[model samples]
Every structure is written in C-alpha cells, then in structure tokens.
Target: MRYVHLYFTCIKRSMISRLEYKKDTVVALFSFFFSNLCSLAAVYFILQAIPALAGYTLAEVGFFYGFSMLPISLDHLFSDEFWLVAYRRVKDGDMDMHFLRPVPVIFQIFAETFQPEGFGEMILGVALIAVCAGQLTVSLTVGALVVLCVGAVFGAVIITSLKVAIAALAFIFKRSGPLLQIIYNFSNYAKYPLAIYPFFIRTLLIFVLPFGLFISLPVDTLLTGAHDPWLLSLAIIGAAAVFFALALWIWTRCERRYESTGS
Candidate 1:
C-alpha cells in the first residue's frame, strides 16, 4: 500500500513535469495519434490491394492490428523511462539520483515518466478495435472476452517485463538500447495474423519473443476459435507472471553491477 501511494505520488510529479510544457505535450500526443493513424491507413491500403492476407479478411487483419496496439501503448505509457535508462542514463551516470532514492531503482525508473503520448495510441487503438469489430461476425463468448481483457492487460505486463529485463542490462554493458530495439521490433510482426508468416518465424514469435502469444493468439481465438479461450487466457496470465518475475530477478542481479561513469 505504501509503495502504491509512492508510485502514484511519483507519477503525479512526472505528470506535472511533462505538463509544464503544455504545447510540447499536445504536439507529442498528436504526433503519436497520426503516426498510428498512418500505420492503420497503410494496412487498409494493402488490404484493399491484395484483398486478403493468408486467409484472413480485411476486418480480421484490422482487428489484429488494432489489438496489437493495446499492449504496446500500455508499455509505452508506464515504462517510457526505461528507454532512457537503456540508451543514455546509465552511460551518463544519471541513474545515480535514482540509486540514492529510498525506493528501489527499478521503481524509480518506472515512476520517472508518465507519457501522455500513449493516450493517443490508446484512444486510436480502442477506436480501431471498435470499428473493425463492428465489421466482423464474431460470436462473443465469456471465455473469449476474458481472454481479450487478460491479453490486453497482462500482455502489457509481459512487454514491460521484457523492457525492464533488457534495460537492466545497461547496468552491465552501459547500453543495451540496440539489442532492446532489435527485440522490440519483433512486436511489429505480431500486428498481423501469424498464419501469414512462415513456420519458423511463427514459432519464434510464439515461443521466443512471444509477441504473437498474447497479441495474435487472443484475436485468433475470437475470430476463428483457434484455441480454447480458457487455456489461452491462462497461458497469457501465466506467461506474464513468469516474465515479470524473471525480469525482476534479472534487474536485481544486473543492478548490483552498475558503476557510475563519473561524468
């Protein structure tokens, strides 16, 4: 409870800092919104040209794309500071301030930024999902709805865990941003139906990076009834728990290796 209060307090401070430049905030929000809009438009154009992708219709593809944004946007909202840590802060010894704080360094990093730009993505994503869902003929089941909710919420946990684990490597290597970028790029592959990919790429997305596990699989379940929703939801929730625990372990171990650059 104390930690939860501290988290909100830190988030409030971060929000104040960001809102200090109201124009910049508005610009950033619009920028993210348009960026996502452009991507969605690209998908629409391609679907119009090709008509279908790997047996998935245009609406199915749109639903997949829209659902992909949920986990990514949530991660972007809460953990944007991890990008700075991975790319700059540790190398510049900027994390010294976080180390001096009473709270855990990881907690401080999590609380350091509250990105309002992600609201743009969230709004656009929800809107796209609603639009695409209306065009599809999906039978809504209790299990299916549960899986979608779990996938979106717990999927964010999985992505954030991956970010935290990768960012923590900066403590040892001084910068892990490139590797993190490479891994994160894999999430893009999840923005489409997994059936469109080759077997090996599909396996990698499911088992290795696991982006497709949470994003594509849940949507597939809804559209095609491909998997047992109860099992898939359990798998997503379980994977989130495991990934978060492993990420915390990795962060704890790597954090001990941090050395100030003395800049």
Candidate 2:
C-alpha cells in the first residue's frame, strides 16, 4: 500500500510538472490525435472500396482497430516514459539521479516522465470501441465484457513489458531508440484480422512478437468465446514474462556495471 501511494505520488508530480508546459502538451496531444484519425480514415477508405478484407466486415475490422487501441493507448499514457527516459537519461549520463532515489530506478523512470500526448490516441480509441460495440454481432454478456476488460489490462502490461525489455537494451547499446521503434511498430499488425496476413507473419505476431495478443485476440475471445483461449492468453503470459524478466536481468547487470559521470 505504501508503494502504491508512492506510485501515485510519482504520477501526480509528473502531471503537475507537465502542466507547467501546458501549450506544448496540448499541441502534442492534438497532433497525435490527428495522426490516429488519419489512420482510421485510411482504413475506412480501404474497406469502402473492397467491402471486406479477408472475411471480416467493415464493423468487425473497425472493432479490431478501435478496441485494440484501448490497451495500447493505456500503456502509452503511463509506461511510455520507460523508453523516453531510459534511452535519453542513459546516453546523457543523467541516470545518476535515479540511483540516489529511495525507489526502484525503473519505477522512478516510469512515474517521473509522464507523456500526456497519448490522450490523443486514448480518446479516439475509446470512441472507436463505442462506435463498433454498437454494431458488433456478438451478444457479449456482462461477465464476458468484464473478462475482455481484464484482457485489456493484461494487454497494457504486455506492451509495457516489451517496451521496457527493448528499451533496456539502451543500457548496453547506448542508442536503442531505433531498435525499440522497430519492435514497437510490429504492433501495426494488430489493426486487422490476423487471418488476412501470411502464415509466417501470423506466426511471428502470435508467438515471437505476440503483437496479436495486444487487443485483437482478447477481443476475439470476448466475441467468439475462448475455444482456444490459451492460444492468446498463454502466449501473452509467456511473452510478458520472458520480456520483463529479461529487462530486469539486464537492468540489474547494467546497474552493477554502471560508472556514473562523477564516480
């Protein structure tokens, strides 16, 4: 409970600090929002011409695009600073400050450097979910809805785990920004039904990268029922566990080898 209070405190401080640069923050927010809106437009135009891509209808594809955004947006809102601060601070030798803090360095990084721009993606994500939920053919029960919501929470953690794991590579490489982005962009596959892609791409998305686990598979479980829930659920657990454990191990190794600017 004490740690929870500290976590909230970290977020509070970050928000207050961000509010000091209100204009810049708002601009960033709208810029990201507009960017995401353009993506939705692109999808709309594609479906307008073809009527259906693979077997999914317009509403089904839109639901996949929108519903999946919720968890990714949530991660961007909170845990994105892991990449922002980890890379920059390490390169600039500013990581020394974190060692002096009483809390864990990873926790400090995530909590301190908040990015409010993610609200752009987050707002549209929720709106998309609403628009598609009304049109979905599935008769999702209250219990099923709750299950999918839980899946969203897991999806956010999975995304963060991947980000932190990749970003942690910065501790050794000193410039993991591009590498991290390369892995992050793999989630672009989540925008459509996995069946539309080639077999290799689907395999990578499901097991190796597991971007398929983000929102699509969980939403599919909610809609179609989890005949093979383990296909996605276990893969998510396995992916997050592997990546997060690797990040922590690497972080520990790097911390032990750290040579501060003054030391």
Candidate 3:
C-alpha cells in the first residue's frame, strides 16, 4: 500500500512536469494520434488491394490491429523511461540518481515517466475496436471477454517485463538499445493474423518473443474460436507472472554490475 501511494505520488510529479509544457504535450498528443492514423490508413489501403489476409476479413484484421495496440500503449504509458535507460542513461551515468534513491532503482525508473501520448493510442485503439467490432458478425462470449481483458492488462505486464529485462542488459553492456529495438520490432508482426506468417515465424512470435501469444491469440479466439478461452486466459496470466518474475530477477542481477561512467 505504501509503495502504491509512492507510485502515484511520483506519477503526479511526472505529470506536473509534463503539463508545464502544455503546448508540447498537445503536440505530442496529436503526433501520436496521426502516427497511428497513418498506420491504420496503410492497413486500410492494403486491405483494399488484397481484400483479405490469410482468410481474415478486413473487419477482423482491423479488430486484431486495434486490440494489438492495447498492450503496446499501456507499456508505452508506464515504461517509456526504460527506453532511455536502454539507450543512454547507464552509459552517461544518468542512472546514478536512481541508485541513490532509497527505493528500488527499478521502481524509480518505472515512476520516472508517465507518457500522456499513449492516451492518444489508447483512445484511437478503443475507437477502432468499437467501430470494427460493430461490423463483425462473431458473438462475443463471457469467457472470450474475460480473456481479452486479461490479455490487455497482463499483456502490458509481459511487454514491460521484456523491456525491463532488456534494459537491464545495459547495466552490463553499457547499451542494449539495438538489441531491444530488434526484439521489440517483433511486436509489429503481432499486428496481423498469425496465420499470415510462415510456421517458424509464427512459432517464434508465440513461444520466443510471445507477442502473438497475448495479442493475436486472444483476438483469434474471439473471431475464430481457435482456442479455449478459459485456458488461454490462464496461459496469459501465467506467462505474465513468469516473465515479470524473470525480468525482475534479471534486472536485480544485472543492476549489481552497473558502474558509473563518471562522465
């Protein structure tokens, strides 16, 4: 409870810092909105040409894309600071301040940024899901809805755990941005139906990076009844717990190796 309060207090401070530059915040909001808009437009244009992707209809594809954004946007909202840590902070000794805090360094990093830009993605994603869901014929089940909710919330935890684990590598290597970028780019593949990909790529997305596990699988269950929703929800929750625990372990181990650049 104390940690929860501290987390919100830190988030409030971060929000105040960002809100001080109101114009910049607005610009950031629009930039993320339009960026997502452009991506959706591209998907629309491609569907116009191909009509369907891997037996998935246009509305179904849009639903997949929209649902995919939920986990990514949530991760972007809460863990944007990890990007800086992965790319530059450890190398530049910017992490020294975090280490000096009485709290855990990982907690400090998590609280360092509260990106309002992600709200743009969240709004657009929810709007797209609503619009596309209305066009689809599939009936959503109670179990399916529960799985989707679990996928969205716990999926964010999975992505954030991956980021935390990757960023911790910087403590040892001094920069893990390129590797993190490469791994994160895999999430883009999850934006479409996994059936569109080859067997190996599909396996990698589900078992290795596991982006498709949470994003594509839940949507597939809803649209095609591909998996047992109750089991899938359990799998997602278990995966999230395992990934988060492993990430914390990795971060704690790697953190001990950090040495200031003394720059």
lDDT of each: 0.90, 0.74, 0.92
lDDT tens digits, residues 1-263, model 3?
A: 98999999999999998889999887887787788889889999999999588888899999999999999999999999999999999988888888887999999998889887777788888999999999999998998899999999999999999999999999999999999999998888898988888999999998889999999999999999999999999999999999999999999999999998887
Counting clashing residue pairs in each candidate, in order, gives 0, 0, 0
How much does candidate 3 score in TM-score? 0.96
Q: Per-prediction TM-score, please? A: 0.96, 0.88, 0.96
Question: Best candidate per lDDT, number?
Answer: 3
> Candidate 1 — which pairs collide?
none
Model 2: per-residue lDDT, tens digit, 4-96? Answer: 888888888888988898898778877787788788899899899995787778888888888777778878877877676445766777788
RMSD of each: 1.3, 2.6, 1.3
lDDT, residue 124, candidate 1: 78
lDDT of model 1, residue 99: 80
Stretches of model 3 off by over 4 angstroms after superposition? none
Extract clashing residue pairs from model 3: none
